[model samples]
Target chain A: MALPLVIDIAIGQLRRRKRQSIVSIMGVALGVGFFIAVASLMQGFQQYFVSQVIDIAPHIVIKDEFRTPAVQPAVAAFAEGAVAVRGVKPRDEIRGIRDARGKLAALEAVPGLAAAPTLRGPVILRYGARDHSVALVGVEPERERRVTNIEKDMIAGRLEDLRATANGVILGIGAADRLGAGVGDIITAVSPRGVAVTMKVVGLFSTGLTALDQGEGYALLKTVQILQQRPNVVNSIRIRLADITQAEPLARVIEARFGYRTESWEETNSNILSLFIIQNAIMYSVTGAILLVAAFGIYNIISTVVHEKTRDIAILKSLGFTEGDIARIFSVQGFVVGAIGAALGCLLGWALIEMLAAIRFDFNNPVLRGQRGFIMSRSALPFIFAGGFALVSASAASILPARRAARLNPVDIVRGAA
Target chain B: MSAPPLLEARGVTRILPGEGFGAPPVRLVEDIDLTVGAGEFVAITGPSGSGKSSLLYLLGLLDRPSAGAVLIDGEDTGALSAPALARLRLARLGFVFQFHFLLPEFTTLENVMIPMRRLGRHPQDEIRERARAILASLGLQDAERKLPEQLSGGMRQRVAVARALANDPEIVLADEPTGNLDTRNAATVFDVFARIVGEHGRSVIVVTHDLDLAARAGRRVHLVDGRIVSDGPHSPVVPQAVA
Candidate 1:
């Protein structure tokens, strides 16, 4: 019977001081909102880091480190022995060769590959009197198109025509624009060794990558080989696999044979990934400080309640309320305040997160300038955080006040003796 | 045979611990034999500093006697624990003081319901209805919702009486309950005592200076210098000797 009365009194008291209650709830809401949003952002960053591994490149890349890529066709020898190295071997690596004869044979060994080697190099070209230096890659048109989507990036002519001539080449649109040339135009190119070669532009490309489009050219490897005079040498052995997921173990096997270093896409940007984790940790710690502030506010409210209700407790004793009962009443009051504040805080915090999510605060993190800000997750519950904070804060805040209420003496209370 | 007295004191005495830098302990009150029967009203009066209030307090179980026995309902209170004494007080006794300490924040109804609710003898509705009826008997039926500050001194004292009787205590103690009232209000308050005792068959012990009010009691005992100098049946008497 008295418990309801006590709860009613608690509600009335809280209602009377609406401003204080709101302020306390706001403090808790801030903590909860910050905590949840930070957590969501951290999760988003983690997902981005992992997903970027597969999105940006192959699952695995194999290359000889501390040495420039060899200019030879070693892929056939490597692929034949690839099965002995402890994992599934898909398509074989292919050297930068012109004919595609040896590379196509390796591709046929693993029937899954619909493609073969992609050629790549650096060349200086001149067109219509003004020219610029750019990276030049040559490949078998049909096979290279199956491996990478170079045809979709064509700005002019057709990818099939890139293999039509020994002197045919393709240029990225930016590279063409820099050289003031287009399809069917002739260009003079030279390697770093000043070995001059003339090529006819059969197609132009634009991959939307500034470095690649502004500096890359494409040609048939046979023409590139004829022009570079390198019969059996290449920069790298680009392998075509059935699935990228199998590439890592396959690359490890291939690397073991050739004694080359292997890399996965995740290894490309390790520093940025680590920065996301560190930033998340710092954010959570700061949010914890905000929760501490909310706890302090709860303490203040309970302390005021203890002061205001002391004499009423004295009269309660005269009426035969036990010390324990009095303590219970006060503790109940503290809990009620905490519960209400927590509930309100949860609402406010949730609303705040929703609003922030709508705005999407799309900016880089201060510590990770490349990272996008503000990620929303259904699993990030601001309310739960607020609720846990409220319970702990209320219990802690009520302890001293409850003890004081219990210690009151009836004789002294009625007479003003204590 | 008649039942034993509700309260009996055999040479009850009280001593205060030394104060003012360890002065010697002083006997606050000393008593001989005394008995209060179940439905008997007894008033204790004294000059200031004569320890009449102190004796009343010790008898009311608010404090322990320095030496001697106070048997309440045939059990020695000294043999009981402090909490047990409190329980006994709650169950059997009520107090009205010179100042109306009727819990200022509570309404007249809430204040009167306190003891009955504390006792937990009845359901909530039963307690509330009984408190209302008791307040009505005290002529505070319409004032049940009014706070202490809203009621006059006389009305507040009457409310206190209703509250005291709410639990049906065997004895009601008042230390100048009408002390703050005017002559007319004081007469009205004292007038409630006879009517209540007659109808309810409850005991009352009052301490007061108004001889007119004192004369109305069934029995009056006087204390001077911490000793009973005169006691009679509501009749004026010359001092037989110094207390």
Candidate 2:
């Protein structure tokens, strides 16, 4: 019941000293507003990068390779773990999965899983007296669409059109530009097995990745296997899960189930993911530092209020106000200030985000050549975080001053007045 | 025997830390015994540094005694927690300091309403009405909305007295409340205290150095070096009985 009275007094005190109160509020608002703005921009870029990785790339890639080299039978037979086999050359290693069809069928039965087998090998593209080195990927168009976004990236012919045309090929826009070819153009591809074949261009795609655009081509799975002289063999099995975050665990499960080397997109891009972590760490620390500085402003204002209100505190104490009441009065003032500041900051931050999103950044930089405006995330998380942080900061800043106010001895002050 | 003393101090003592290392601790009040009965007007008088204000603080429950207990309505307050003692003070006692230490941020009515609000027994409207009535009784109805700085010294002291009586406590303890007032205002303040004891049937304990004002009270307790030098009726007719 006395809380309302305490709040009234607290607000009265704050209103009486309007200049200091407003200054402290502005300081906190600035901290929270900048925190939200920076977090939105940074998180927007991260989400953009993650989307690109998940859209164009497979969630997990199971390859015909081993994470660890096979130990020789002779090395394990004798020598107590210290045996080094000398000059024992191994036999020729098979380069493709022997049971890819079985593996693909098994993967299809797993819940929320999609898999596509690809016979990928290096090749040369020869068109009209021009020769270019490129890697050829063989994919079943329907299954491939479940694993990657090749269907969406198609700007020319349909990806399903490759199903009817046995030797139909898809070239990236960069490759098509270099070859001076479009749909229905004939191109000669020389497989790594030294077999040359002519395939008709069926589709062209632009995925915004320069390396993939310029250096890769896709064709039907049976055609590539026949051309490569490895009939019915696939070197890679791409998998996509319903939840991208589930990729790592599912990849480990698949690796353990089959003796295949499996890697999730997160594992393959661990460096970039770690960089995102560092970026988040730096962003939050900067935000926290600004909030800490703003807390000092609150501290200064509250300390002044305590010094100015000493006589009032003594009077309240003489009137039988508990020490806790005195402390609550000041703390309630902090709460009011902090709440108002955070609300204003959220509005300010939202407006700044809109303004930043509207402003064009036309640097013509290669990485963001066609990107028109700043990437700004619309997530409410950063705003919530900033508001919560400000409240905590203001509350923490009020404690010392409130304690000092409560500790004032009424006798000493009244004696001074006498 | 007479319904217990409204406010009583039995061997009350307050010792603070010494000024220098290894020096003897300073005793603000030592073993001072005093009592104020219902409807009694009592004055405590002493020279400067003689513990008049300190003893008043102990009796008001604003300070804890180092050795003995101060009792309110026969309840020993020694073992009460700080908040419990504050509650006891709010419900049973009120205090007026020499400075009329009203909160400057609040108006005169608001200052008076603080104790009533802390006591939390009445609704806001009732509190406000009671506050206005008290201010009106003290002839401050027109000045209720004025800040403490806007009031005269005497009016401010009267406002302080109104605030002390806000909760209608059993005992009103004042420490040199008229020390800063002129002679005329001081006489008015003494008259207010006499009426509070006589008409309202409440005990009034005042600490002052004005010997003339002390002589008018029903009883006067004189202290020297934290011990009572004399205590008894000031006249043959009790002041409260006459009023």
User: Against the true structure, whose TM-score is highest?
Assistant: 2
| CA-lDDT, candidates in order | 0.69, 0.88
**B-chain TM-score for every candidate:** 0.93, 0.93
TM-score of 2: 0.92
lDDT of 2 at A175: 90
**Candidate 1 residue spans exceeding 4 A from truth:** A1-5, A8-286, A360-373, B1-4, B8-34, B49-57, B62-70, B77-86, B102-106, B209-211, B221-243
Clashing pairs in 1: A71-A233, A71-A234, A72-A233, A72-A234
DockQ of 1: 0.20
Writing each residue's lDDT as its tens digit, candidate 2 over A75-100 gives 76875877867888778766898699
- Please give me the DockQ of candidate 2 compared with the native complex: 0.59
Note the DockQ of each predicted structure: 0.20, 0.59
Residues A29-141 of candidate 1: C-alpha lDDT, one tens digit per residue = 56666666666656655665555444423344444352344433455457655434345454565443334455446544764544445445678898767969987776677
Cα error of candidate 2 at position B3, Å: 3.4
